[model samples]
Target: MVFIYVLAAILLLIGLLLLDYALGKKHHLKNVRFLNFESTTGEYQIYTAGDPLFQDLFQDLRHAKKTIDMMFFIVKTDDISEELLEILKQKAEEGLQVRLLLDRVGSFRINSKIIKDLRESGVQFAFSETPKFPFFFYRLQRRNHRKITVIDGDIGYIGGFNVGREYLGKDAELGNWRDYHLRLLGDIVQHLQCTFFDDWYLATGHHDEEPFPTETEGEKWIEITATDGVQLEDVFESLICQAKDEIFIGTPYFIPSERLFKCLTDALDRGVNVKVIVPMKADHPLVKEAGLPYMMRLIEAGGEVYMFDRGFYHAKVVIIDQQLCDIGTANFDRRSLFLNKEVNTIIHNSRFVMDLRLAYLKDVQDSQPLKEHIFQLNTIRTKIKIGIARLFRPLL
Candidate 1:
């Protein structure tokens, strides 16, 4: 009788949580907003690893003249993060207008005491996309997955690198980390700053505006895109459907929506080269399995797939016809497409894209071609996991 009562209580609690999630998640995505897209020019340099990215970012923080603003999906508590915190603290003490916004659930491991310390040290810190009561369950999974830093008002850092040791390749399980980050110099920095402040306003109820950047000395045309989650598919679909010659995609996850999958298959049918690179080893359970069916279908359709064997391939990149490139925080997964707030920087053809192309080729060279036999479901357990992943694909 006691066991039955305990099970009943547990089930009741889950039902209440689900109800709360349904109510709270309705407004979660709508709450996050972005500035209007204004095309501009910027000089960009790509960083393929965290060591160089962080080293340059830290130095840039030290050199910042007026303000420092940052936002990230996750900020793991470790030595590397401590180093960054110390820098921000010291910079804050020096009277710089410093602000940090972290996704509440993504960085839940960061203790309240640390945040208090930052506040006391003059840093303005707040949690973004925090779930509220009555709808907490659904809202809790919604996230601000953008990673960006704007120094003073001239330099902008954007892409997948977050503040953590694992991002630095210190995790024993994931092995070396591979990603793409960009350091930008131009008016786009102002645009990034305005977007950061808009996110900050949503999180902290404070609002400020920065003017859009104008023409600069660079020849590269760029656009900063912020998505409230639902609109990303349209943007990506348009890009893919318009591809003339080839499509190159490198992402951590590959569970695309039905339309996206069809688009890729059609691209293959049109004889447009479509190549995708995914990590050989999955950092999360079932993610690799979830993509196996897609990979096999692509292979059946004459598409090429590469398994990045050198490390965890976390680069969220898409190159179309060597004329444009997208490098940002989004993955080729349903979660990114329909759930998380994302930011992507689009770069038009230039010498920069040519260099990025070379880097992409190098990454492909470091990977192994995905063979259908080696990856297709070979066991009941694997099939079961894939089945489970499919049921939760939207939340993956």
Candidate 2:
């Protein structure tokens, strides 16, 4: 009994030490707001593809007086991308402290000349993480998927869009990929700046000491929430429990954790109208296969599911009860919920939710409904593929 007691005490001490370390990290992250957007003027803007949002962003980049920090999962060298690169280069030449970070994996296909030109023009660049054979497996999973842009420590941008021809409506093959982005001018911009700095530090081992804006004059209350591993796994469960009235969600992938699946089922039992839209043609075949079982379950619970027919439905958005909404790069799948460093914006604005609902309705109009009978009609080969996908979902 004494030996067991001693072991328990040692375990308690170790737990406390871990708790202290986690608390310290959380305190450091307090400089970055998790779920709030603020500015002095209460003027926040939402931008989408082909909406002249890039023009406003370019104007801000041209007028930046102090520093510019940007991080993206992918950066292509297409026309719109070239335009932004030129502006960034010009800003760097003007002596503004310019920093750009891109994921090595996502930007691997991009032309090397574009990166060389940016570097030659004095723009600082870093890759989020590079794989080194033996140590690559663990490092590759924790990717910097958040897209952030901060200018002069005051204005910021964060959302799902990447610097690519497809996103900018220039991909001749894809033809106007539908997406959403937000331009922030408030306290939340500082959080974005801090997020960039964290990635910058991780990439280059340098941290910025300047004070980022935490208070701004914006009216609409927006909160940015992020979770990875168990924390992320739990957040969706909490979101599911809090959902009331209606839940409208759209994602390119749809594999869900059991807890989340149960929460949605419970919400439906309580008379909540649950609607979900997923891509009819997913970019990842394994993910599409893994999502089939979940679709069948959701349909069993009277949840409405729509399969987008126009190209790939890459957007990740969720609107709860016409009051709380989330938009960002994180998809509703095991990979995003467990391994990737994902960011999402939660808005508590009715107007924003309404706008998102309208957009979702438009997407629904373009989608084909997945009737309950569709799952019943699947062939044996399809079932075998789903089984294989389920087995490999963690990697997918």
Candidate 3:
């Protein structure tokens, strides 16, 4: 009995040590300063108030000379999809190494003809592992929720935009979809490239031979950090906790982890003006149902919640203290926090943050306030549904 007790105590200590090490690494990366050019000079490219995201994406793809790598959760067969495919086919035909990674589950409805066409055009492709029962709980729970594209290892794009008509406001049922995507043209692009390569090799069992691009010394400095099951310290939660004065967050789904909820509540307690905007009508009813219970807590704690009435609010962004912004595909839910392989760009530029804030303001104008009365008025049946959703949120 004495030996067993000692062993248990030793195991507990080892677990604590590991947790400390993991959290320490996460904190270190969160605090790493990125050089913001706007701080030095009063000028920066803060593109807000409506920019043609697809046009920029097409231009970047058309200019790819050596390599084009892309990873996305979904790739619908739409106009944008066909245009992108044509550009990629042309690039591959020009001897450029083009690769695409799609999630098997998300793109399950995608026609096989499109895959055959791309493969016949010499574009290498692979599907992220599908969730299989009994033998693949890890793969089933953890998904590659990153939407990324890297061109020539110098230019990249990352954000919540998937390859779908709805994302570009081209779907009849999903009109005027609001989303965000960034065009990166510096050292951070390499980080995005590395992320794509890691996923590609994991899916296809082939690795790229090219050296990773080094950090480019530019006027603007940015760090791209990612989180997966491999690193389970909740990097996004840390960023939210670090917010001091204000936080403007927008996500389609807002079923937050406990750590993230505490962080936001603490920020509110510390007098941070916290505002969260979620879609009034989410594409997934389960996510919308799961998000309602948490709003009353946030509102009572001095935080504000709004539901976007403008079609679908699919973008995931957080502007912290009006100085730092994170834009990515990760939602504020258990899936993104603990299950999905998510990539978020930590931009320490005030200009970028301001731009994001402005966008949030516009989104707020288009949103309806989620008052305490709504929660009070829900019937018992609705409450039961919400309860079930909350119970299974981690799996959702």
Candidates ranked, most accurate by TM-score first: 1, 2, 3
Q: Comparing 1 and 2 by lDDT, which wins? A: 1
Candidate 1 residue-wise lDDT, 1-396, digit = tens: 999999999999988977776665566555645457888878888999999999999999999777889999999889989999889999999999999999998989889899999999999999998877657677777788999898877789999988899899988988899999999888777777777888898888897855434334665789998887787898799889999899999999999998999999988888899999999989887788888889878888998889988878999999998889899999999879887888899999656777888888898999988874554557888888878888677677
After superposition, which runs of candidate 2 have C-alpha atoms over 4 Å from their true positions? Answer: 1-42, 110-113, 214-216, 372-377
Tell me which residue pairs clash in candidate 3: none
lDDT of each: 0.86, 0.76, 0.75
Backbone clash count, each prediction separately: 3, 16, 0
Candidate 2: tens digits of C-alpha lDDT, residues 1-396: 999999999999877655654553454344432432242233467775644667888898999998899888888767777888899999999998899998888777556777788888889988886655433454455566788888988888877788866776665655566667788877666666766777788789898875466445677777766554435666567667788798888888898888788889999999989999987766656788898889888988989999887766778888888887888778888877765677777777898789889989999999888884485549898889998998777655
Predicted structure 3: lDDT: 0.75
| Model 3 alpha-carbon drift over 4 Å, by segment | 1-51, 132-134, 209-217, 230-233, 372-377
TM-score of each: 0.93, 0.84, 0.83
Worst 10 residues of 2 by lDDT: 33-42
What is the Cα-based lDDT of residue 266 in candidate 2? 96
